[model samples]
Target: MSKPRRWLVAIAGAVVAAGLAVPPSAVAQADEPIQDPLPDPVPSSLGLTVAEFAQFPKTELTPPPPDPPPDLRLIRHARINHLGEVPDGSGRLYVPDLNGRVYLVENGTQHIYVDFKAQFPDFFSGRGLGSGSGFVTFHPDFKRNGKFYTVHTENGAGLTKPTTWPSHSANPFLHSIITEWTATDPSADTFSGTRRQVMRIAEARQVHAIQQIDFNPYARKGSRDYGVLYVASGDGGQGATTTEPQQLGNPYGKILRINPTGTNGTGGQFGIPSDNPFVGTPGALGEIYAIGMRDPHRFSWDRATGRMYLGHIGEHRIEAVYDVRAGDNYGWSEREGEFLYKRNDPQCSVYPLPPDDAQYGYDYPVAAFDHNPPPGHPLCSDSGHAISGGFVYRGSIAELRGKYVFTDLVDGRIFYTEASEMRRGRPAAQIHQFQVYANGQRTDFRQLVGDARVDLRFGQDARGELYLVAKANGKVYKVTGIKRFASCAVGHTRVTGSGGADSWSPVTPDKWQFRGDSVILAEAGEARPGPRRPFEYAVLDKGPAFTNARVDTKVRLDTPVEVTNRDVIVVFGYASDTEFYYAHVSTDNTIYPHNGIFAVNNADRLRIDDQWNEVMSRGAPPAITDTAWHDVSVTHCADTGEISVRVDGELLMTAVDHTFGAGRTGFGSFDNIGRARDFRATGTAA
Candidate 1:
């Protein structure tokens, strides 16, 4: 759904809400494995074996604490499109809607201290707000000058009009203008000011509108670098079709670093920094920081590392987070992530690998997922979406230290990666896997007040306090901790032999469930996977001497299936291919599945297959059997539209379905029929 126009302000006020605190610190002690609160339980539609779906070890040591409450709250939620932090650690969040409105949310207030739309009716009165403006940042000396800047998209004539381009063509003439404003009094709480035009660029129909703006923190006051503003513009919104590369003169798809004071400007006008990358480069905009960026929604520097993080929304198959370096070319029209995007395709460029040193030279995404998603896991889906960049946590929240938080605008899922774990030598660095949680459950948190749309942009102040900017509802929400019940450990097991038995014994007191021979020990690995390991499963009858829970057991598949069918239902072990894997149930054979399915289709093969072709011998299958024990879980929740499979703490498959339950539940070859000629189901349950 599209975002709303009005911004809403919903604060906790004086009331305390439930489920709002950080998970207990005990959960992260080295001796104990940290666990996030279990997601609201739901039923599963996919008919999976008890051993197919399991949980994995958390990549992050601990989850971040909930956001703190704001001191002041807005009357109604405001659709806050952009967020900016002042040098003094205060912030101003902006909301520009189609209603010809611009609301400014200042720090320390429950109301918009200044409504630009109300104050500047002549400029904003009738303009149909398109994509909202970038964040509003005060001049470096804003405390003294009360000067601030904003970049917004309005109609060419400041009012809505019919499109002049073909219906098939992307809309052009969407003008994104940057303006400067000065407060009448520096000491006043309200923005009583005179508006001045800084710069305006006509918007092309198909590419990115203006994204965000930031002043270099390192620049000294009144120095040449002062007033040096950085603006992240997209490739004119229509992917690559509506714009061209080497169009250096146009500010369509590049990061423009301009001195806002103009050449003959004053303290309010911007001044260009002499050291800007393109200062002397011919054919380049003198203010350009770096070019070839597409839909760079948010970019920020680490207070500690000075490294910049850019979240670039993908055109088709991937969404990437980039660690930007100075003067680096991030292949856009020529490439997306490591793959080549075909220039001719209106949808996006093709997946051709770029050369090593061309502007087309490929830059690796810190983290990326397939545009198309697997069932049960919605985070992988990108289809025509935007990605919001976030800050590197340098906050008092201990768990968030050195972590970068980002989110997808469509799914509302927040994720984080550890800076310490990023690969230093790779062209594309690895985003060390981490954990995430939903922000809040309030309807206000979900809806944009102005347009009633779901907005999930994240903002941070100088103190590193995080806030959520909602686009659909136009509200700013401070994420704070809510009290929650500690999650219990759950056990997963696979069983073999006629009477083989395996079970999970929880170190902590908890409830348990038996789904065939596999036991779901409520919170089994509470401390560590080891203290409870050396698990025993009784064998009543012998069928196949399957490699039972051994680390790194290579499973060789005789035949190849479609990559899309690489669905596996593993309970306690890892399985990448269709065959040659093992399973484990409870220590006893009480709750293990008798039959389960592991399908290695083209998609599965492509995932594990080093070679792209659909040949079994051409690729290697994942080693599912491990000497070191691990936990796996498969949960089906119909009410919430989720079916999930986890292994050794990592999530593998998650599908969404309306179905509630599948009565039959065992392990080994239930729905999967791939390479079954030599396949045999062995175990007491089978």
Candidate 2:
């Protein structure tokens, strides 16, 4: 397909009617409008103000001030739910919207990666969560092999192999297909990936189609989870009489673990992992990893503890999180979060009814809360509406470092729990609410999307920092302000004054001419890459090799911003120009990845360890190109390997790294014109 036609189909609303095998004529009619089999009702309640939901709970201990300040900033606006990351270092990101489009995000911008809506034009995309395109998972060796997979309901009869079990009926249920893709170039923005259908799953219902697709992160190259792909099989049908969750005859209401590469012992396109709990069982399916779960939609594994955390939606009453164990049964038709469940009762799935431990033997929830109750339990309905699984905090946030951070789908409320305390038998006290804010002020996520359904889903970057996605408004947010170390206290040593001829020395060749009060840096002749940097710069000469110190610079760009050159640059923790970190303030109308803290390896600039995903546009923080002298400061904590950037005396961003220690301070712009006026370097004599 031509690029123009690809973009046109991507922009136009398109959907595939799902079933067995699509007619050849149907592929030609791919641009038709999408109609859902069933429409989902709008969520109840308008919304709550930020103050109403935020809890300023008193605690005896806290992380030292300012790290991970409770604030979130919308980074990308898209209708994407599940997130996929390439193991490559550039932090290349991908997400699939239910509209059947997959987007690749680069430097806070979205590009069309693939359009499944056009490929499978005869697939079902109902108004429910399982509709449209399902999940995407990359191969463990995706970087080298360029292989990946995706799941969506389809009518590709030619693609499906005969099912050993009774797969689908001719009525409301459909066939959900999982397809593999091989990328020509694994790092490209365009979809040069070729598709190959892997498996066709028969669903008894439309809503609980194939939901999850993931390769185990903790599994070593030789371990059981290493090459295995874990898929969540919803009870292929809906309604109370649907007891497929109890009957392991089919892979519904259960977690299916498989080897995508048929090279294993079994004989199929994908082999069943030998270690699967049901592999040797007489009556159970070999692919069944665990049984008895309804809508076990969003679950994650903690790299720190290797514990599987799952957040499942309740029938109408209790929302629960489970510490998933292999072969464990989460009683859906039998019970909801340990409560006695009557499948046919009108209030069967409703909440607040206490559990009857004497009844069924089931794996209960680690934490659960009643959302809406009928008549009896006053304690019910206190928590948020639905569950959206999140990750354990292992990033720079000191206070929330070891806790589990997750949310509710309807109200967008946030909560955390001590990883150790949240066990199988723990009660409601194990869960705790955490106040969320935007730039240190309280803000509600529902309000972020104008009080609509925050169908809240969570994602983490290659750095393990978390991100939130709101499907209603197609928005993405970064949970920022996690401070690692406090500001470096500059002691008695002070080299203060305008960085002019006497105070500055040309680190590279001399593109900087020191005026009396300010240093003017401009391109010298045909600009060539310096030994340390690509542009000319100046360094502070009189220093004691300062270890922990603070340096500030007042920079002014030339009139009529030069769009071709690098932006303002300040280097610190500098052993040499080739071996230091710098604050590459965001540039306007530039193609380079600027406006973030960066490190230097072999004199080339690299991104720092950050709670990242910042959009470096004119709308971003610190408009440095306005020819105004903005105050920029870089603080280094040698003890902690952290660097914090402050623009105009306010905190801009904080990052952690220990590649280089205390050297000297320097300033200049890359192949551009800028003026450095108030250059002050203060610290204890190194």
Candidate 3:
């Protein structure tokens, strides 16, 4: 494979996103590792969520441009095809490209581990959806067994299945084959793996030959699901509007299960698991696990909570997500999502529920949003098409645990929903649109992603951290929790704050008191005050001195007055009280410079920018009078003489000046009362 490429290209704009807001405060506790830019929230009315998403660092996959389908918005095959994590504790991800290559992703870097083109040149030189290499899954005991499987299209060569498919199209050599390969040294970077043709299905068409193959991740060693490989096959509906989606005679449009090992029981190369639903059924193929679906593309087994969420791209109107089960028939062609797509048309016909609809023999999608969400749509169509299924968050993120994180490929609409109601096809999961904030601007999911046909996909590492695999962009992104500190990457430094002098360290400590880890500053005995005694700063001498970096803290303004010229302030970027930068977080935004940025120079203090526009400072969350401990951070980029301040993870100010460089960071209040703690600063040391 070519040299590793830097796959994740930073989105062109700053994204401000809203997300699960627990206030993300560690002020009350001492050892809560504070990772900042933590999710602050926007009103639920915005119908958007702020969550953390970062591009998977390092690994890159670059392929030559434009495969056959020219006008097709995205390269039908090149887009992030699929993301799978090896069961091995190495935290490696196997990214498969339909264009014939396997990427082993580890620690932000990807190495070409399997080169299909080089290994089997003539075998994969094909096009269209079903003509190339597709899904890949490691055997359950792959770590010890070194076994894995792949699905690809082959013509003429090891012809395992006959060409007498259910279609009239006399196409020879075009067959979809499932093959198993064994690695000599599974843990090595590049190993010579020998392959065996597992099973071959003669193709009728190309569009939906097959979709994905997933081995149950939650199954125990001796459980029924342990060694069973579940494969989703489409009806190969390339030409006709629909056919065979509901037909069990042919394995198309149905999810099939088989034992990759052992002898054949149902005429296929691989042995059929005796527990399969259709084994003794009259006309149904013994391998049929479930039926009545168009293309069962992306499916994931939630290891956290036992749930199977499958996204079946709709024919025209509705896209769906279903809690798949054995023997269940998910209606397709007949009904899309919960809608009655077609009653009876030659092109496509409906399989109505038993008249009273009492028996849901043909299951409806559990959680499906409208493609456009038209007027009567369940979600009433906000944004998105083509669903990207994700794993249930079982990681450290307390709020998102057990919540399924999924996205729409067309609009990049990210969402997290409860699984229980969704599994039984209850009212569409209360969809909460996820938002992304990067650098400065909040990003709308639609704008952050590429093409419409580009069905984005999601993956989870062993750690349960989710990742996005984009088809159009061919990039992988790791979804992480918010960080509370500024990396100061552009400023060339990244460091943390050092502990400071106790509130008793200063002489005029009127009402200021320190409790070892925090400080409380109140204007005790001094009543009805104006902005007197300009800067009453409490410096943390332990914070690393930096020429360019960010300082952060959780502050609670306790003053409740309606009108007061005084404000609580955090002073940083200074040599002493005479020269420093202070953020005056005040209760009222009615007056200019009242709640804004100011700098002290030669004993003269003034607003960094005369006009208090968004370029300088903005209102604080929950009216500064509210006693909630909101996060406040000030970042200085020495290279550009720029300074920015963010409150509760939202950028509120951007100002530039060459006044001060290196200094000790601290917090303070001027003629007002406030409590502050969890003081931290990370950036390059001066």
Clashes of each: 159, 23, 31
The root-mean-square deviation over C-alpha atoms between each candidate and the true structure, in angstroms, is: 17.4, 23.2, 14.9
lDDT of 3: 0.61
- Name the TM-score of candidate 1: 0.59
For each candidate, the alpha-carbon lDDT, in order, equals 0.43, 0.62, 0.61
Of the candidates numbered 2 and 3, which has the greater TM-score value? 3
Candidate 1 residues 370-399, lDDT tens each? 343223333323343456788887877665
Worst 10 residues of 1 by lDDT: 48-57
Using lDDT as the yardstick, the better of models 1 and 3 is 3
| Candidate 1, residue 237: how far the Cα is off, in Å | 3.7
Question: So what's the TM-score on candidate 2?
Answer: 0.57
lDDT score, candidate 1, position 506? 23
Q: Predictions ranked by lDDT, top down?
A: 2, 3, 1
lDDT by residue (17-92, candidate 3, tens digit) is 1211111111123322122211221111112223333232232222333555343443443544677788867677
Could you estimate the TM-score for every candidate? 0.59, 0.57, 0.58
Give the C-alpha miss distance for residue 405 in model 2, angstroms.
Answer: 1.2
Candidate 2: where is the Cα deviation over 4 Å? 1-78, 155-168, 263-267, 349-360, 373-384, 482-686
